[model samples]
Target: MKLYKTFTSIIAFLLLTSCSVFEKNRSEQNELAYMKNIEDVAIEVSKKQYVNLLQPGDRLIILVSAQDQDVVKVFNQNYSATEQFRESSVPRGNIISNSQPINGPTYIIDGDGFIDFPVLGKIEAAGMSLDHLKQYITSSLKRYIKEPYVQARITNYRITVLGEVRNPGQFTIADGTATVLNAIGMAGDLTIYGKRDDILIVRNVNGLISKERIDLTDAGFIDSPYYFLKQGDIIYVTPNKTQERLAKRDPNSALYISIASIVVTIIALIVRK
Candidate 1:
C-alpha cells in the first residue's frame, strides 16, 4: 500500500511539473542577476544600437516637404500638375500615392542599389542608413527647392518569430522601434515548455547569416549588441525536454498506457474483493 501511494504521488508530481521548464533552474532564470552585487556606483552597459542600413530590393517611403509646394510637386504624382509624372514613376515600380502632394510613391532600390529621383537622376542608396540617406536627399534638394525637408523610412521593417511561443508569426517593426523582448511580447511571450534561458536569434549580418542564442531571463541581454532585433531577424524559441518527451509520445502509446492503467485498476479491485 505504501509503495502504491508513493508511485501515485510521483505520477501526480510529474504531471504537475510537466512543462514547467523555468522552475527547474530558478537561479539561472533570473533576468538581472548581475545587479545583485552592485552597490551605488553608476555603471552603463552597452545596449543594442539599432541602425537601419539600406539594401538592394528594399522599398523606401520618401516624402519631401518644402516652403513652395510647386517645387516639391515634381517628385510626386502632381509634380507635373498632371498624370504624366505618375505615369513616369509606374515603369520604375513605385507604389504611388498621389492624392497628398507631400507623400511620394514608395521607391524600390534597384539590384545595383540605385534609386531614381526627380531631377536628381539615379542615386546610390544602398549601404546608407536611413538618417544618412535622408540627410543626403535633403542636402541635394536644397540645390533646387529652398529649405527642403525630407523624411525617408523603410516601407518594410519586419521580422519573424517561431517555435514554443503562444503566438508565432511575422511582425513589422514600425520605425525600427521594437526590441527582442518586444517581439516576444508580441508573440504573447514564451510557452511554459519554452527554454527561456536559451532563445535563438537568426539574422543576416552583412553578407553572412548569423545565429545566436539569447537568454530572456538574463538582464545582461540588454547589454548585448544583438539585443535590438534587426529587419528579417528570425526568433526561434526551442522547447524544453519535457515538451520533447511529450511530443515523442505517440497516440497509440498513450492509448495503450490508458488501457494498461485501467486493467491494473480492475485487477487491483478484483484482488481486494
Candidate 2:
C-alpha cells in the first residue's frame, strides 16, 4: 500500500509539472496570435495612400513616338545606342547613325537632378510623375517631332530585404509599382521564426526618411500606405523570441539535461527509501 502511494505521488507530481509546461507554451502561442492581430489592424490603416513621385538616382526608360520617322529617329537612336553601350563597353559612336532610327533618348539624371532633352534643354525630372514629365516632354517634342507620344518609367526601382528572411538582397521590380508583400515574396518570403508583426520599412520621401512597421500575417496589410513600396525602399524583418533563444542555446549542451535527469532520479530514490 505504501509503494502504491509513492507511485501515485510521483505520477501526480509529473502530471502537474507537465500541465504547467503545456500551459506555459500555450500561453506563449496565444500571445503571439494576439500580437499578430494588432499588426493586422495597423496594416489595414496603411493602404490608402498612393506611391510617391520619383526621386534622384532613379533610372528612367522613356519612349517617344512621332509621325515622322526622321524626327523619332533622333530620339530613338540615342536610347538604342545607349543600351548597347551599357551592355558592352564598346564604342557606340562607330555604329552607323542612319542604320537605325532614333525613337527616344536615354539619359541618367545628372547630379543636379536634371535630364537634358534634345530640344527641351535641361528639364527637372526628379520628383515628377511620369504623366507630368511626359506632358512636358511631349510639348517640347512638337517643335522637333510632329504629334509626339511620350512615355516615361522608372526602370531601376528596387527594394532591399534584410534580416530574418530566407534570402536578403536588392530586388528589382520590372513594373513601376511593387507592393511590400511582393517585395517579400521576391526575397523568398520570411522565415518560419520571423517576427511577422514587426516588419520594418524604411522609405525616403521628398528627402525625408520615414520608418514604418508592418504586419504581414493579417489581411489588413493590404490597405497600408506602406503596402505599395517605392523605389529604394528597405525592409527589415526581426527574429522572434523563439528564434533568438534557439540561437543562444548550444547544441552540444546535452550534459545539462543529463544532470537534471540524474538529480530527479536521486530525489525519487530518497523518497522511496
Would you list the C-alpha lDDT of every candidate in the order shown? 0.66, 0.66
lDDT of 1 at 231: 77
Listed in order, each prediction's TM-score against the native is 0.63, 0.61
What is the TM-score (0 to 1) of candidate 2?
0.61
Model 1 residue pairs with clashes: 31-217, 31-219, 73-79, 74-79
**In model 2, what lDDT does residue 163 have?**
89
Model 2 global lDDT (CA atoms, 0 to 1) = 0.66
Single out the weakest 10-residue window by summed lDDT for candidate 2: 85-94
lDDT of 1 by residue, 41-77 (tens): 1243332356767878777777788888887878653
